[model samples]
Target: MTASQDIISLSNPVLLEKVDKLRDLNIGQHVPLPQLVVVGDQSSGKSSLLESLTGIPFPQDQSLCTRYATQITSRRHNKDSVDVRIIPGPRALEEHRKHVEGFHRQVPSNLEFRKQFVDILKTANERMGIRADVSSGSGTVFSEDVLKIEICGPHEDYLTIIDVPGIFRTTTQGTTKNDIVMVKNLVKRYIKDRRTIILAVLPSNVDIATQEILELAEEFDKSGERTLGVLTKPDLVLEPSAQAAVCDLVQGKKRPLNLGYYLVRNRGPNSGLEGHSELDKIFRKHPWADLPRDRVGIVALKEQLKSLLVAITQREFPALLREIVSQIAECRREFNSLGSPRQDEREQRSFLCQIAGAFQERARAALTADYGADSVFDQDELRLITHVVNITDVFNADFHENAHSLNFEKLGRSEPSEEVEMLSDYDGVRKASSIISDLRTLIKKANVGVLWSKEFVELSEIVTLGNTPMPMPRDNFSEWINGIYLKSRGLDLGTFNANFIATAFAEQSRKWSEITKIYMRRIIVTIHRFIAAALRSVCSEEQVRTQVWEAILQHLVKCYKKAMDQVDVLVEVEHRKKPYTLNRQFAEARSKARGYRATEQLYPKARKDTKQFGETQYVVNLDDVAKVAEGKNNMEQLQEDIHDILHAYYSLAANRFIDNVFQLAVDYCLLHGPSSPLKVFTQDWVINLKAEQLERMVGETKATKKRRSGLAKKIADLENALKILVS
Candidate 1:
């Protein structure tokens, strides 16, 4: 090495060494690291510059250096040593990483260093699955894995420099279009970090405007803050004008950079200039002599890079320390969330029991509506009781608003338009048309006095179940009731038959089946959703989650079927059995309904008999009113009474059924029983399972194990990095 190259201390050795250890710990994969990274276009003289700086001869050929990045780290130590290893990329497979990590070689000083170093790189390439020859085509042409070479000596400068794969625009025999994009992305990944000092390499012969490396550097560091341009092969630009342009760039006369540009003349394999002293002779003549002395040679470039790297490290160290502490806390939380690994059958069983206990605790919280401070309960779908009650409230409102088969007020106003009646017959029964006509006549007279009771008026304001109500016009309902009355009529002549009342009540409630099905489906879906969310929180492994789901599915199906059966029974009793309720609300409803027969329309109005005494006069006579009342017969009054009775009984039975369904079918069977679906997964259930079943139910998957291992390694690395920064 030249005496001028060693003129400056490379860096504060202690600070750079600390950062180097942190980089070696691979915490940079989680966060950015402070270092110098070399980036340029393909064939940009980057390798020759690195060889000049490190005094380690890199392969002069372009094929070997462009495949992967190389990291050269130098440390000041008591003994001289050189060790080489491969740090696998994030995408490397487990077996590939294992094989690559096992590669280690100690370069002996007795042998030639360049040959040994190049041979080691070739071996590392094969280990990384990159083909030796292009035509062989069995492996990749480029990789993200880094080749790490560490040098330690009594007088070595403590520094770290990374050479990233050169960016390429086209593909060759072994490389595809994908390789072009891959190389660019790899370079960008390295230079994008704010802590990385970019050494943008440019060949002096190429047009500066066309070089890709400067464009990228400008893109990432838009302020030109951390980039330093290195112009190589200055002797190749022989023209006076072009040489002045290069001199102008070096002096910041053209495109200015914060830390401007440096010019270096490196010795190629075929170049006559064998050393730095020989190269200095050419710069002493002609146009290059006009440039400043500090920006002209390899030694000056090294000193500038060393000083810049040290400055960046000193400025970013505290921020990096805070970042490490933050990462340690976050990674520790994620690692703990994965829980302890289960290795054997006993451990798997115990793990399953723990999950089950957690499941039961959350499930109990849902069942009782006891949502405490846990964020999991914040989601509406997970709160089982609240969801069930909201749906039940909708069900109750739906039944009250739309359960009855008839709307009496609407039917009374719009009577059937057809008038021909009293002739058709089928199956030895009266035709529905004749009954409709007869019933319409009665409704027109009875509707004047009809008014909705207080209970029915309030039910009108409640929201429906978002479904269209069953259409039963008054004429159709009257026809149906008359048919029932005829069939049930017996020894009761002047009075109405009570048997038809049950039949009318049963017919009005036929919609209970459809409405109940909708309600039950909602409850089942809510319970199933809550179960899935709870299981996901408790168990991290997908296989175990699936097994637990299968176990719960069986119990869930049984519970739903049982609940539906119970619901069907409730419907059956309402349909097949007699209509009966001991509540006093029935009496008030019956009295209100009977008032329809005595409307003000029944009274006769007195008309002017004659224009008396030159003025119009009106008179009210008792005889006229008595005659109007006497026109109606016993049969009409009986039909009106039966109609009123049917309406009163339907209202009474509907409210009773709504309460029973929410309590018995929903609460008792599916949500609260000993065999409830919510209680299917428990510690008792895990204890009862066989060893093989437990193994299948709770065993950790390969992906889970791999993730846990990765997190454990990351946490250890971060903790170590924190210690290095603090100490």
Candidate 2:
């Protein structure tokens, strides 16, 4: 059998199955056809172009002649029958709500007035009228509304010609704001499908070099649909030179896309035969004239009525149907893939549980190490360290909060009051002094000589107040305290107290500075060794060794500087000549040291504290870590849960993919073959009923030629069969 016959035969079983499946699916039945959506600026000849192409005298002069998106379909009827039915535009309820509200506001006193006014507005908007109004007590008030028209003609068996509202007008006086929104909604709804082709009309007067057309083209191009540009009102150009100039302006400019443009004219009374002929000659000479002429035919308003009938009823529509079917199938595949929903929650749940368990174990180990075996600390040294950690945590949290909140504060605002600063200073002094006293006791217990006599106490007070360095210890008591403090602080110790310690120590330890240096160096080396060992244990030795060494070196340098600051602060306090200068420096130092010690101690501990973190890494085979009870209830439950989740996801994806394939196949068959249910439904009911009703009621008939042609073919086939039987 031939390709056509093969297609028809294949469609029989397929079409039947599709019909049954569609009923089972309960999807809306749609008659597929190639859609040519005409769009342009208001009064930019969108309606005129439709009239020209279809030969239908659509109310071109009506102020928004195409208000709603009208869809036109071509159908074949019996001999001596030609039908034209205007399918009503889809009711845009959301758009109409604004109009209804506007009417209510305009006529607040009369409920009936608002109702009547809105009704007229809706009618006028849909029919593409200039203005719609209802008479009130005062006078007739006009409201803006636009009309949208869809002209169905007999050009092709399944081709649809849609006339859209004009865009890029200087004024939308006749079109309501909602009308514009409606047009955009229509474009989004139709163009997103990729099955529809957009025929954008541009006025010849607009500068092609402008950003307007470029942006418009970009919007359509990005949608992944085929968009064609038609330059309308060529007849108005009058001069051949002007037309050529316009063409060159469009063609020469560098655009986002290599958009094709066509010159078109809508036949009008002003556009006589001579004018049309001249316009035609000018269009033919243009660089883009080689496009198929039949697809780009031009006709006058009166002639449009006849041409449209022929165009809508012709075999060209069947070819369009094939193209639309193919496009929709492609779109279906893409949409199905992207729109697939999340599947098999049970499987996801099981995996989530496994991840949770791993994190829980890690969390417990961390909490125990950081908080210690007992929840409380009785040792003076441990209590001091814990207090420092608490203070550091508070400072870190507040600093982060202030950093973020400072941006929101009003500009040119005064700083916080001195009372607040004094209170903050008091709190800092109390915490630091308490921690220092505890440290003194711990040092004595550890066999470090008592370094806190009356003189040392006075020096400690001065250092605390002014961040000054104290005199070098006679014994190595200072070295012992520094070591204990640095050890407790961990990695963060380097960041928090580097500056304070550096300046204080440099001045205070001038006499035995070299000995102080030796003690500080030992502490730095010890911290680095600990950090490196910890890093090696957790991460790969090969990958992290270099990074660990670099980090340690940086921390040591930072801590050395802070230790020196402590010495400097103490020396400055001792050498000051005037009490005023000493007091000022002391106040400044106290304020500066508010969060330093706490910050230093907390920084290192924070790095090691991972109790709060859950599931930093995932590892396979739980059996490797612990024995698995194969037949245990808990293990069985976990295994079953994981299995269910995996199966669920797989099943969902498989079902969805299969359903998408089947649906696409059904749509393809319906759009292509003659015996498809969609075709039969459209031909038997939608087309036939509308045509018969229009003839019986409206007493209007446009063209009967297509119906006559179908009859002639049928009769010829029957006669040939009879002759063959006789022979």
Candidate 3:
């Protein structure tokens, strides 16, 4: 058996399933077998070639014998017969009669009826058995009809050949009447299921038009289907040498016709024959005649038909079957990959809602306990209370100008708007609302929060309190403090503090400097934790771990860069500041600045510079702490450690998940294997053949034990091979 046959046998079950589905769905009407379409200029020997390849007789008279696309298939009757089925394009049958009359009348060619011209010529061939003389009128007299011919051979295998309308005609028309469109549609239909192979017949007389035909052939071959070129009318050229030269020039070794070309003859006894003596004569006359002859094949018209029957029955049809089965499998995989969109969306939403609920619960608890309900007459009231208490007296005094402006602004605006201004005093509350709104929207859209919630909180806190202290009215200290107390809001301060403390602890653990990092990390961690928890709680523990680790790594990269930037800025400031001078008043100011600079430089250095005592006091430390700090002051081990910790944690927590993903990737690759066409064909052939054998061997009688035994062995061997392939 051939490689393709082998694959078909192994994948017989799937192939059968696909065929059943096609039959059940009645999809065969839409997807036909792979068609080998032949097209060329009028009198270009297209029909003659089709007859030669399909072993079917095509009328050779000057009259257009085939009007529309005729599909030919091998049929089994008491005697072998070729069933010729005609599939006319829209309005093709009606127009065919008119086209024939028009061609005979020798009427002037109308541009509007250009397509109809080819159909008329085809109809004349089909019914009247007349050929239009090219010298009589323009090519537009021909009609637009895709001629289909199915040649049923004595054997089970037969190829469907589509003889397209000729391009060249005496008509004034500049284009091949509907030929391109028909060819394109043929390609689309064939490619849907079968691997379409184009057999382009190029006349030995080379021209710009022939070159264009070769170009189109190349474009059509990109569907991963094979395209074979045939140099026709070898007898027309007198010199064999000249003929070969023309063939090489027309069919170059480069793109489109890279598969090489076959020399053919379409007149006399050798007419419709490929690789015949006439063809060899042309090749021998060419410079590249030294090329292998096996790459080229030849036969007379009658012999060509016989050869085509063998080719289709033995090779092409089986290969086409393999291609169809493979395409079906591919379609199945694509559908599987897409999954159920609604289910996916619903799952995502559920996850987001869960995280959002958690966030809302935490935030509400913190607010109610920290700021009393009585204090929070509205959303802004809670902010106003927090702003009054968190701001430092000194900073509040500095903002006295804005504070007084607030009273006037408050009177001008609504109570809610005024409270919003006061809450703005504490940058945290001012920014929180915007940040929360954004978080809510993202959560709703993605059905998940940012994985790093701790980071965001840290960022908010730093931005709010980095340069200012809590601001409150000192004149009414008790009342001011009590107004913002938990008791007023019917909330417990301990509960609020507990939630705040947990967030604060997480921030310290992460050792993040920038409030942005804090804010970002908080959202990221929250998302990560939620996903991890949900996966663990609802799905597999391994999946939870895998997703959490992936999320953590993605967020870590973001946080690491932010931390590095902050460190760079700090380092730059320390490097640019000058040392202190205590002598003058300006010197005193410079002295404090220098001291602050020294502290900044020393702190980083001490943190980064590690010490080891070998000989104790007797040995001077080779690495100077101060110098090391100055050189590498930007080092942030704490940040790096946090990343390492997260990585290690996830690795330990989700190792199974990682392993599963890895295994999945490996399995996918094994199933697909190398994507080279030759390899795919071989693999598919093996699979198909095995499947076919199995199906045949499934049921056996005692009388057939001998045959069944051999088949059973073959099936065992195939199963073993399949196991090895999958493994």
Candidate 4:
């Protein structure tokens, strides 16, 4: 008879109840629920050992591949019954899930379960065919799906043992060199979970070194902390020397384990089932069975496991309470993160409204700088109206400062020669031509250039021979006005014209259009960012969020393209075709340059032989002469006059161009073109959407929905368990 026959009730019923709650809820996925994980080399009699321990019928044909993880959980109960479930692992195949789900759907209720289970395993494998190569690095891959069997019957000890697929050393027909690594990884994953206690099953018939399970156990649970060594098929250890070695291992004489080894006799893989009487006859006759009760049989191993589990539970219960609370909190956070589903049509419409309202409010706040006190950046909080006024001030300052900073001018453009030929040597004209070339260089550059007539250069380079000369030289007038262009705008009346300035202005206008394009891009990018933020807060599903983003982006692209095309059309059709002509100041400068043919005719001078006072010198200032010459304008004064007018016109027009560019960006790109990205987002795209189209666009996948619901239910289950544990 088995050892449980004498036991009246479970010694750790509360612990068993906790384990049941964890298993039923599938809480180990979240918080690593504690258990025993069984692993061993192939043909190590792992299946028989599990059956004897739990008294549950499992797939036992040696020819059939175990291809998946099997979890066996059994407890003593009033009646005999078995429950079977399939849990798809993380690496489980999609076709495998379909096969399993299909089976669950079509399975008959009144059928004999044990026989049906064998057929179910067979059907699942046939549907989920094996693939040897999964990746370049991995040689052979298989399913990690778990086949869980929960059993309850009279005289069964409460236990949960996971039977992993057997480890292999060599390549076979359906397995490869990679299969050896894959199987080991599968075993390690189960046993590596901290809450799991390792059960390293081995065959006494083989060398202990070949049992890879023992090596892995020592590697993961060094010092045998949570490891139990179980030796199966002791009857097969027929040689006296092999028997002595197995006996020494059980008694802890050699290679001592903290939780020592135990020996059991069972058929490893025969076609028919063996009754306990046949095993009892062999055990009664065998010399190894006489060693010790605690180290020899399945009954002793069951008792040992119960005592060990009880002690481990006592030590781990406090941590388990903490784990339950932690897991509950984690699940709650994840559930809230998933948010309430938008299954209702009204809910979808309301989400669009929220996105629309947030967009407009944020845009208005940005324009008005009314972000209330919680604005993150000081820059974001700055008033846009104030920013515009400040930028205009900067524009005005740049206009005046750069106009004064002309790099090319009349200063020293000519030098004095010692002879009368100096006046006609064309030195002044050569100097004037060089000055014009410099002006051309500064045409589109920020540092502009201005010029004056050669007559002006000749007049400025002169000097009075002596006071005996009755009238002062015209050179005096030029000397007085050397730096006049610094304070006042001046031009070479004899050389360039207003049309030249207009062509220069056109170059600047073209550059301005490129700059404005950059501005347009910046505005569109800012709006794109706002649209994405709006989408994230409104759309729950990734597919829907992506749809909204693409719609808005494509809309903006079309709008901006049209605006840019209009600018090019405007430039070609109207702006450049009109003939650039001279204005009033340009015409006046032309007349002045022709009249003042000689430098002597430019400024006021003393009378030929003045006797008003003996040798008293008096020269009229050209500034007054300039005031006088202003009304009596000549060629020299034309240079300064034209310069003044050009600056005035260009400044006004440049500022106006800037204003036009900015207004277009605000109106067409920001507020209205193609209704703007933000406005477009709020539009009823769903209005014309077909039922199937809407489903495809916004509907969640079955797997995603299942995952979300599963997490929520797990959270609730954990919370309830946490309350019980804590109390």
Best by lDDT: 1
lDDT tens per residue, model 3, 29-122: 4333333556555566676666445544456544444434454443322443322222333333345634433433122222222335455445
What lDDT would each prediction earn against the true structure?
A: 0.75, 0.37, 0.38, 0.57
Q: Give the 10-residue window scoring lowest on summed lDDT in candidate 2.
A: 403-412
**Tens digit per residue, CA lDDT, model 2, 427-525:** 453556556455445433532222235323322322222223433234332343345344544454123333433333333323333332322232222
Residues 3-121, model 1: lDDT tens digits: 21231233478778878777766667888888899998877888888878787787865457658888898777887778888888867787988998898988655135556877877
- For candidate 2, the lDDT comes to 0.37
In every candidate, how many clashes are there?
0, 68, 100, 4
**Which structure among the candidates has the greatest TM-score?**
1
Per-candidate TM equals: 0.68, 0.31, 0.33, 0.58
lDDT of 4 by residue, 260-331 (tens): 888887655563577655664555665676667778778778788877766666566667767777777787
Decide which is better by TM-score, 2 or 3: 3
Our tally of clashes for model 1 stands at 0
